[model samples]
Target chain A: MGKPKKEPKIKRKTYIDTWRFLFQIGAFIAILVNPFLNYYFHVKVIQGWYQSIAFGHLWFVSPLEGIEALLITKIIYMPWIIGMTLPIIVALLLGRVFCSWICPINFFYEIMDRVHKKISKRSYYKRKPLFTLPRWILWVALVGELMLAMIVGKPIFVFLSPPGLVGREIMMAVFFHTLALEGIIVLIVLTTYLISQRFFCQYLCPLGALLAFIGAKRRLIIVQDMNTCHQCGFCDRACPWGIYPSRGEAEGIYCTNCGSCVAVCPFNARKFVFVGFTPSSEKLKLEKVPSGRQ
Target chain B: MKKENTSPKDSDKRNGEISRREFLRVLVGFSLTLPELAHAKSKFFSSPVHTNALRPPGAVPEDLFAGKCVRCGRCAEVCPYHCIEMLDIRHGLYAGTPIIYVDKIPCYLCMECTKVCPTGTLKPIPQEETRMGLAVVDKYRCITWKGEGICRSCYNACPYKDKAIYLDRLRPVVNKDHCTGCGLCTAACPVTPKAINIEPIYSFKVSKR
Candidate 1:
């Protein structure tokens, strides 16, 4: 009732959103099936090509894994460069598209979001402008810790990622055929999502944070035309991450580019556009949608 | 009027209330803290890596290998003979890394694993030059050494029959100079608790001449 009813004549662009869903499901299935392929078929389909375009790389180690190896054991696997380069190029070009279009974690979080809507009558999310460090400051502390780990000779953040945990567990379960205690950590993350909406995405995930850091200047952005938007905040309710879409003007470091808010808008005020090439449209008429924090 | 019976379940279902966010903040903290407890166990215990673990050929020294290996399992997957086995987490720091249990499944040394190694955790050395380890025979336990009509099993099975293993008074004597330590002889030896075993290079550090 909060949003105005749309005219049936307006054909909504649902296929693009469906494309994202299909990519997500397809990516998730590819990851879930990959570890079993080598074990069952005795064939190397990918042939250690962990860094594929489909799911990207699931290898636990990367050239950018940093000095954790050199500092800890004084050795470097020079070939790990194969693992790091492609993802860095992707992040530089596309931003954190993985979180929205590829990450399996989002699928699980979506399920938890439904459970929360049913069981818990709260829509509380502690987000944006975290303390004084702007929401965009996702990678600084962890990256700093990574440098320090190399200097100190110990890897600290190796297992901190939920996607990495999921990848590791799926690979372990298929190859070893036993659900190890590591699965418990994955369960805890799932339960955490139930308790807090987008807490990990907004505040914690380092991989997403790293991508956000690299992709902050990306041209592809979610733009909301202030002239049309009611600012009724229905888009806020629809957003699983609970971010106000109107505030983005265009790009946001924290935005996963999931497009749920765009799908729900009755007025059709939002659109994903390339701002880098646009002449006058590049000048975004940004209106602060009252973060209500001050 | 004050709300008295506010259970956490019935707790304010809306934002703008600081308590619920604080509760969520605490739950997030709890999630991270739970993993920290598991980490503490590793801190107190010694590394679970086996002392005499015979790694696949082309593996770098153990100390360096742990840092370099991503354990993608390419070496094991490409092996013409499935002699390579990836260690479980029970093997401690080297978990998911490749290992060889020569007794259960001996390496034929086709050298495919070396070429398939993406990270060079296992170096790409040819089969002939691979010094995986040195095979040592115990004279006392060997059936041939007991004068029981010379089994000759170790001599026949050795890839380098004359250079690596040769008959001395009808009993095989291992020549350390020419042995590549593929463990074929150890596996082929027709004796329980095989008389010959590879002294894995990682177990003891020695200068190569």
Candidate 2:
């Protein structure tokens, strides 16, 4: 995995590589215009998908509010079933793909990471993707906090979930005609990325953590052909999350499926593959150290 | 400095002090401490809704509604007339939840918001069956009841027409059983003090139930 066996024919990736870029733009446009149009054109609001595009109708944040509302009001708010199901299914399939493709804040984080590299000439992340309490621990923390608050009668996370804040910020901008404090928090988070590699996504963002937990059991993973992998370690250097791509392990929960490593690989060894599709991929699972290492 | 040569990834492979499952146990212990701070459990549950505010048609009773309502603003977004507004911090525990200001913009009875409610916060009752509240006529405030000018506007504005309100002896009288309490009549009342008003179902008072 150290030296190139000739220059490895780097082939262009298939459609999946750029689909995230298209999805990010699509979601951004929907989030930006849904509120303004829903307000001004309530006449045509009619019954459909476009309606939930409104600020308060944030699909992502709506589901999280159930615990708060149930605890505070004792009303179960069953409609949240719409808000929770699809994203979760995607997480189980692709593993936090929303962080890379749809999170507007993450779009800004990438720009900041680029700027940081230009200025400091060193990896902003001094360490590899820091193995925190794994995704499940954080997921429990979120649910426990919600249940605890519900029993106690004070709804939490309503004011705290970042996606909800993003919707609020967008709504205030469209309707109130003034920026609110939430925008400043977003700005602070974006600024943090310039100083630390993906600080907000890594240490904070409960929603991202939720997806990470669900995504822990995902099927699609970046596979590297050992025959072609000249471990010049460029893929590891290219990872924004600081994962060691040369490690040739099944991806961890933290992988955003952004495929930056695939794009950066000079050798065409790295490509996303559905592990169970072919019989041979059973061996491609993430390589763990022997059991006693811990 | 002595020559040391180990790849950074290999040297950092030692697992940290806490295993993922073990940390969950510690976190769960912390989770148990939260309910002790719990106090607002009954705030939105038992009705005679503290604020006495008008909600969208099919809204749950206030006491239980507050706990169930996430206040994501979806109801306001989907309302065809845009009559719904999220109450701000001034509403305390009910902040960001939907309320219909009867005089500013009354419920139009289009029944669109009910269809899109992601949660059961707004019960999906049909327009004919909706009992948002009962329309009560303040006879003392009505010029018609005072034997002055005959104002039939409340009766005329009632979506249920004769079923919800009727012209009796040239005065508008509300039939509570037939009334949806949409406040259309209240919004149309021409009398300066307003002759007809809808009593919100959850208004804190003698239980309407």
Q: What is the C-alpha lDDT of each candidate?
A: 0.63, 0.64
At residue B161, give the lDDT of candidate 1: 88
Weakest 10 consecutive residues of candidate 2 chain B by summed lDDT: B43-52
Best by TM-score: 1
- The Cα error of candidate 1 at residue A86, in Å, is 1.3
List, residue by residue over B88-142, the lDDT tens digit for candidate 1: 5454455556788787777888887776665666788867778778888888779
A1-294 in candidate 2: lDDT tens per residue?
335577556566555435656676676776666667777875334221221333344444333454355445543344565566666678788887878887777766665655666786764224343343343455666678676666756565664455555665666565546554435666777666544467677656666676777788888777776757666777777777645667753267678888877876766777787767767665654422222321
Q: Can you give the lDDT of residue A266 in candidate 1?
A: 61
Candidate 1, A21-106: lDDT as tens digits:
77877877766776667678765554332222122223323333433444565544554555566666676666777787877788
Candidate 2 local lDDT, B69-168, one digit each (tens): 5556667666767677665443445655678878767898888777667667687888898877788888899989988887788878888898889888
RMSD of 1: 9.7
Candidate 2, residue B98: the lDDT equals: 76
Least lDDT summed over 10 consecutive residues: which range in candidate 2 chain A? A46-55
